[model samples]
Target: MEKFSTHTGIAVPLRQSNVDTDQIIPAVYLKRITKTGFDDALFASWRKNDDFVLNREPYRQGSVLVAGPDFGTGSSREHAVWALRDYGFKVVISSRFADIFRGNSGKQGLLAAQVEQSDVELIWKRIEEEPGTEVTVDLESRTVTVGSLTVPFQIDDYTRWRLTEGLDDIGLTLQHEEDISAYEARRPAWLPRTLPART
Candidate 1:
């Protein structure tokens, strides 16, 4: 996964709140095995309207999503994060997020920034008024900035460290590679074997 110290891009204002995992990529689209290529499936229902926020210009290319409170509120699906990432979103801003969804996002390297509801509305107003304005999300600074306005966002210290360091679950595990290798070398052959044991 890529490091997420700071990301600046066009911000898409998703006015609706309580956006669930199903609304993100629907269960029908989960058939694909790969982590990517789900871009087309993202917001499948909403995108059909042509008037959906994401279907609009500049927003179609946006990498930062500023959504209302209670975002990612439904089922726990890592695919939801995958869909957002595949759709080119590097960060998602919301006042509140479901616990499971937030966890999935962190593991996938998607920065889920929790800002106050008032700040979220302010962000929406800025983006909606300018329509294509770029917003900067600085993880290191723990702030989201649009034009002259800047608002703080909160993320756990551990997650912030992991994201800023570009460490995912697999990356975290690999940090102890030498220790794991050494331990495995000391294990008895009788413990287990991929290949069948000789009779």
Candidate 2:
């Protein structure tokens, strides 16, 4: 999990609403347990149409996905986050997001920014009108800017801190591994033990 700071990059406008987890990465691609290769499978069905925004060359390399409301609205797969991250997206901005998807995204160090629908529309238009348009998201200031538009958003202090530090759930737990091991060692023997029956 790389630490996030101010990011300025090309914005890919995915104007469709209610983009579910399946669309983000179809179920067919879920056969693999490894998180390394899902990038190729992202928006698989949509890309097959050759008319989707992601299929367009200008937005192909974009890292910030500016999408419609209810982005990541279905399912609870953490793979959605992995697919996005592996595909080089660091932030996903939308008017709304499903609670579970948002939680999963945060755990993986992806910024799920909630901005007004109107602001989202503005970004959508900007990208369409100017394919080379660049946007910047500043996690530190909790703001997103594109052209003349600047939108302020709210993220919990802890989430923001984690993003800035690039600490995922595993990273956070690893920070206290020593203490956690010590506490576990002090546990009562009656605690359901899995240690090879003390051979």
Candidate 3:
């Protein structure tokens, strides 16, 4: 996971609400084994329309996504988060997000910003009105700023700390490596210990 303190980039407004996991990456693309190359599969169906927000110029290169209410609402596929990251969006702002999707986003270093409905509309307007304008998402200050409007958002303290530190579950565990190694050294030899790697 990457540290997310502050990010400033073009904002793409996705007006659709209730975007599901299947629509996000589509189940067809899930068969691939790799975790980081799902960009082409993101919004795969919608992109075919040629006029989808993500398929348009400027918005196609946006790194920040401003979406409508109930933005991420559907299944618990972590691939949805992966697709968004691979598609180059560092932050996704919306009025509401499904709990599962929000959790996945946090673990994968994608900021799922929850704001009021009015704020979501305001941000969407700004992005759509100024196609290539930049929006700044500051995790430290818990705010999203674009043009003359700035809105504050809420995220749990622990998740915020983890994101700012760039520590995923594995990264957090590795921080206790010294203690883990010490405990392993003290283990008795007759406890049916596991074998070492064959390498």
Among these predicted structures, which one has the highest TM-score?
A: 1
Instruction: Write the residue-wise lDDT of candidate 1 on 1-199 in tens digits.
Output: 6888899999999988899989998999988888888889889999999899987897889999998888898888788999999999999999999999999998889999999999999999999999999999999899999999999999999999888887767767899999999999999977866676666
lDDT of 1: 0.92
| Ten contiguous residues with the weakest lDDT in model 1 | 190-199
In model 2, the clashing pairs are none
Q: Which of the predicted structures, 1 or 2, would earn the higher TM-score when compared with the native?
A: 1
Candidate lDDT values, in order: 0.92, 0.87, 0.89
RMSD of each: 4.3, 3.6, 5.0
Query: Quick one: ranking by lDDT, best first?
Result: 1, 3, 2
Model 3 quality (TM-score): 0.85
lDDT of 3 by residue, 1-199 (tens): 7899999999998888888888998889988888889999888999999889888899999998888777778878888999999989999988888899999999999999888989888887787787998999999999999988899998999899999999869867899999999999999987763576444
| Reference-based TM-score of each model | 0.86, 0.84, 0.85
Which segments of candidate 2 are over 4 A away from where they belong?
A: 170-199
Ranked by TM-score from best down, the candidates are 1, 3, 2
Give the clash count for model 3.
Answer: 0
